[model samples]
Target: MFLRTPPLTAALLSLALLYSASAATHAKENAIASAKESIASSEKDSTASSAKKSIASDSYTYANLHDVRVSHVYLDLTVDFANNALTGFADLTLDWQQQDADTILLDTRDLTIKQVYARRVDGQWRKVSFELAERHAVLGSKLTIKPGFQTQTLRIHYQSQPQASGLQWLTKEQTASKNQPFMFSQNQAIHARSWIPIQDSPAVRLTYSARIQTDKDVLAVMSAPTEPGTARTGDYRFTMPHAIPPYLLAIAVGDLEFKAMSAQTGVYAEPYILEAAAKEFASTQQMIDVTEPLYGDYRWGRYDLLILPPSFPFGGMENPVLSFITPTVIAGDGSLVNLIAHELAHSWSGNLVTNATWQDLWLNEGFTSYVENRIMEQVFGVDRAIMEQALSVQDLKQELQSIDADDSRLFLDLKGRDPDDAFSGVPYTKGQLFLMFLEKRFGREVFDPFVKKYFDDHSFKSITTAEFERYLAANLLDQHPGKVSSEEVNEWIHGRGLPASSPNPQSDAFLRVQQHSNAWLSGLSTLSELPTTAWTVHEWLFFLNNLPLNITPTQLQQLDQAFNLTHSSNSEIAHAWYLLALKTGYRQVLPALEQYLISIGRRKLILPLYRQLASTPEGLAFARKVYQQARPGYHPLAQGSVDEMLKAD
Candidate 1:
């Protein structure tokens, strides 16, 4: 993972030694237990606002939280599957840092407020006056409540609207086990307001506990640890000792079962998919073991993965304990399991040390991406990690060309814009390259320690870009002035385009594949002559992606005949093949491509297909036809992307 900077090799070796020594003495069990206790005691100022002032963000939340903080939250909810809504009460424990603070505001969307009450040391719930601010089209309404000065607890009884953006209610037809309905929540980038009333900002972190009552036939799971012996009682109690931003508060209810991969790691899916999920992610526990030395510890009690039905929006969400994953990655060949590494890395980068605001999202994603590659290199192989890195760079370059210059920068200005606009590959890829840049310049020996220290210091806290920059300056630059400078770092973080010092990712296997692709396109090699056996999915993707644009239908047919790519089971390879097929007018893949579109809801794979398919009138017709049928099976987030792409056409 290091370049030929003169001192880097020594630095890398020394870093490994340092990590080994420190990890040997690290008390992981104690740390996790202490964190849980701290969460139970509500001793953290986890809800402190970001270093940036509230005005710095374009969020609709009206409260100035500098004087008051919510320390912990309790959710008592009942799932009404018939009505597709949540009838619940949220009890927020507040710490009034300022004696003069009498009123507080929380964000809400499409929610009907039933009652508001407050209690103090006297322990009596008294009625509290509250007002709902005029709602914005996208930002939702703000619930302003007068809880009186120094009020310790504020409780609101409310019911979420059926159309709450965060909650997705699916019919039995949408699930793998067609006999049961499914429900899950996606609350990132401010959607939490749509389901639960809270200070919905990444800056505001708080410990939470939940009591969810669901149908007896369904299993209830949340971001917290599952309460014992409640599986059959229809009453589930869970607690999370670690404080997290509201967006990370997740819940799902379904006919689900768990299968353990190791003592502390496992998988959850429907009865039919459980075994495959368990096998597909068997490397997860090892990923955790590999990652602990790189960072300090896995503070989260247990790490499990929940494989959502096809329509789950993202590849993986780094939910504490349970990482919600898309079923598409269970390719049966295990080539896609690196996604598990990416999410597990978030246990440290995102779940432990979070970005204070969406503008600084790179802090969460970029670091996670880098750590993911490192873990993949250790647990999978170096070549596998290199292949993924090259793919990431390809994506980053394409994204840079397509997006606005300002939007391509590592530090983003998402003010007055939907934060989702900034959730592209830039943060994940460009951010990783930025860290790679530093590692190359300063050497891994010096850089690795800084990363471990960064997480150690910022664990359970949200940080801003400015804070990170200052920290880097104090830790890395001040100690080794000649290695890297603040001005050079700024060019990577704030300036547009890849910096001159950006890491050039090179994979030997990818290089050979590219050469073969060039030779085939140049008429120097025949398809039958190429060394086709022993190729992994990454090699196939490199070959397909590097194929000549505007390929002739004959060439596409030759490839299809030789590789059977149009019917490939691997989603990664199939996606690449389908895109080339569409471009080359290889009509044979039309049905398979359409079926692929219908079967998978991963935005990374489908949106690009839909966008490319919409280019021609006939293609647009087919895309629209498929979308009309597929829309019901997609999560709102995925549907929203496709809807806009089709709408524009």
Candidate 2:
């Protein structure tokens, strides 16, 4: 309706409409500003994600390899035993991938950095600033150095702490000679950062050279071949021309003597252990000789063995040219030299072509293990190889019972965890089995060439599991479509538990041993009636491992009396026997077990005993007591493992 309003009322209505229009304009402006903020946030997130993807895929390292990488390293160092430290200056040659990068990153643990200097192409060293980030429990610290974009080289002056996780310093009493102190480095599975300021990931490979000054009384050895006829003048120089992951960087200083097993192979040990170690590992040359035709030629110049003291943690560490071996494996006879074969196999599988990250550890270990069995079969016999394979399968099955489903897969996901945790039977044995499955299907006639090609193609390169999977598909699986399916291969690598097609490694020797073990357990035969005179170490291990869990203490005593198991010189057999004793509450072996624990620090042989003991209250007390005494001598790796186990209890 059209009606005339009073002048005051009309003026008020017009003012109200103007106020509403102003409020609407302010609300529209606010909405537009909020939309702009949201768009900016999304763009920022996208940029961050792209930058993260540009970084290397290795989860265990803090290195910015996308911007800069180490091409080569030169170390000048003094081994100061008085302070139990390594005083060194590392000269790192950088490969600047991004020309704009003004800084470089390194990994370190328990290191005292003194100074950092950078050099440009003009060759003038200039001091640079650096920062050491807060230390992490497992990953250690991130070292960032602002060397500037013009820098070509970085020299870091540093000293390792006495209690560095990578270096183990031993008093004279702890060594075999008992006359000279010993020091060795165990740098595998991310321990290299504990001693050296490096890009310590397996993905980073670099050639290295070193000059080490030691006490005039001792000898120095590294993972490189020894200089011919070099005098022992307290100065040692080493050069590894072939690129290797930092973990393979190893060193030892001790009262060591060398004995030649062959022109290209030898053994280094204390004076007392020299002759026996040489004799025990005399077949190392044969192992190398046999491995070449089946796999590839050994590219490393010389393959030598270093017999570390009893406190060496693992059975053997495959340190390129010189493999560090535990004294426990020198079982008087050569039965344990299979460990040598395993390490030598690493020349091709691990050292030549390494797993890019710890997640693909199976690529190194599994392939090496499979090649080890083949080498053993060539040097020893098929029976020995079969027996070892069967034992490995059994060990894998038992390990699977305790490991998580994801961890049991051939391709491990070890993000946010120590690579050492991946060092289990899953990678070593299960990985071998997966390869063996393919070998069984394709036959060695066809598979051997593929394996040899795989090594040759990837030589001196670090590779990821996905890259291997693709290579396998194109080179093997797709090439022979009907034999093995890609789905099956994926299941073996990614699925939980063993596949139905997994190989069942059978051994006639083990069967005989099992039959004898069963007869004794069933009370149908006496322990003496079993044919034990000609039994090998593998047979003995099978016999001990297959014994019933409900076996009586009296039966154990009788067996010990018959075989002298308490005094068994074979470490593997002794370990198995001690495990049985603990299970049955047989206290007679306690003293010997304690002595064994104290003397030999090989984790494979002793950790099982400690774990079995910690399962009971009394056993836990005993384990704690023995560990307290033994902990002083163990490598930091072994110490941490046992500590975590006992802490859990």
Count clashing pairs, candidate 2.
Answer: 0
Off by over 4 Å in 2: 1-56
| TM-scores for every candidate against the unseen true structure | 0.91, 0.91
Model 1, C-alpha of 307: deviation from truth (Å): 0.3
| Candidate of highest lDDT | 2
Q: Which stretches of candidate 1 lie over 4 Å from their true place?
A: 1-60, 227-230
Which pairs clash inside model 2? none
Report the lDDT of model 1 for residue 649: 29
RMSD per prediction, one decimal?
A: 8.9, 19.5
lDDT per model vs. reference: 0.81, 0.84
lDDT of 1 by residue, 1-649 (tens): 1111222223223322332233323253233223333332353333332232442343535545666667567787999999999998887767555667788888898998899987644455678889988888667898999876667677799999878888889888889889789999988888898888898888777767676888888899988765222455577766665668888999999888888888788888888899999988999888988888878878777888888888888899998888999988989989999899999999899988998888999999999999999999999888899899998899789878988889988889876787878798889999999998888888889889999999999887888898899999999999998888888989989999898889989999988888887888889999987787978888888888878777777888888888888899888889988888888777899888878888888899998899898899889999999998889888888888888889852
Write the residue-wise lDDT of candidate 2 on 235-346 in tens digits: 7777665668899999999998888988888888899999999999888888888888998678777788999999999999999889999988888889988899999999
**Which consecutive 10 residues in model 1 have the weakest lDDT in total?**
1-10
